[model samples]
Target: MLPRGRRRARGPRPHLLPADARHPTGRGRADGRAGLPRRRHAAAAGRGSAPRGGRAGARAAGPRSREGRRRRAVSDFARVASAADVPAGAARVVNVGGRSIALCHVEGDAIYAIDNVCTHDDGPLGDGTLHADRVECPLHGALFD
Candidate 1:
């Protein structure tokens, strides 16, 4: 006896009060009623509990040992410029122990030191462009052989 708009399929119900019943404090349902849709007491009074270290206190804690290995050793012997302050093929931006040591002579007696900056961006390999042992990078030409 149903065909107009079709309506007859009540298939799942049995949940007779056991899942935290509710509707108690200030008694409602069964008709004596209060508004209804309190939404679990307004979602437990607007989201209250649950901050105890759930997802491991929301992650972020590694590198706890070995202190970070420690290794910084670049010295090899640096006085920089003494053999008459560089003049033969020219190239001299010496700082030495503090680093920034280019000091090139590249030919007679040979004096190449390298590393005056500009491994790409530090860009001051004594302004760059030595040629023999290679330098170039005056802020983006980037040769550095």
Candidate 2:
């Protein structure tokens, strides 16, 4: 404390939020969403039972929908590269038809492919680092599986 000639310099005032406005987990909005619009899933609100995937209430049975159907075959996938091309714990960007896809090699026997563009910022997903089944975006650190 200054006795007579000086007072302490003060910084910016601290801001406070209402108790109800604070998230219970202290990581997101008060509603527990990470800044995304709330989904209307009944189970989320504890109002109704979650739909069974075998029931898969997401769509109705119709020509345009396959809510509870099985495909005849998965023979349409084109073989773009061999597992050797994407080694273990690495990624290889390849063109299938006309789309740029990233083939992530996990362990030694599993390989997963996804769009080469990052879902968060459209960065090059293929150029990112690979860990198990997930990839870290090179541009913004977003992780995708």
Candidate 3:
């Protein structure tokens, strides 16, 4: 006597790929691989053109070493917000030149502008706690002076 319910059979396990097939190169990602398959990019596929600033500058402009690539100052400055909007010991987030910036107002009339991202975990520094002369990240408690 079986219960009045339907049952399903188990399916076969999927095939597993070999270690060499999983990582085409013997040196896995643990070995600090730098190069990527050109086919993955549109430039390599002939759909788009290569990067500008030459190879040396392009390589140095990565997320790890952005300061290595020199950039000219922007002559034009877009007024993001008024100084009164960000009171002293407080911060405000603004967008300028297609970038997220943190506008912090220190003591007196001195105001500081910095990237809104935390360097430790790339978290939003705009939502951090503002101290006397530093901003502390809410996620990992990393302070930015």
TM-score, structure 3 vs. true: 0.47
Q: Which window of 10 residues has the lowest lDDT sum in candidate 3?
A: 29-38
- lDDT string for model 2 (1-145, tens) is 5535696557744437644556767556665444444558876675565465455444444334255464444576889998778888888999988899999998757999999999789999999998777999999999998
lDDT of 2 at 130: 86
Backbone clash pairs in model 1 (N, Cα, C under 3 Å; residues 3+ apart or in different chains), count: 0
- Which has the greatest TM-score? 2
TM-score of 1: 0.21
Score every model by TM-score. 0.21, 0.54, 0.47
Give lDDT for model 3. Answer: 0.73
What's model 1's overall lDDT? 0.63
List model 1 lDDT by residue over 26-70, tens digit each: 344433434333456533554544345463322244323466443
Q: Tell me which of candidates 1 and 2 scores higher on lDDT.
A: 2
Pitting candidate 2 against candidate 3, the one with the higher lDDT is 2
Error of 1 at 108 (Å): 16
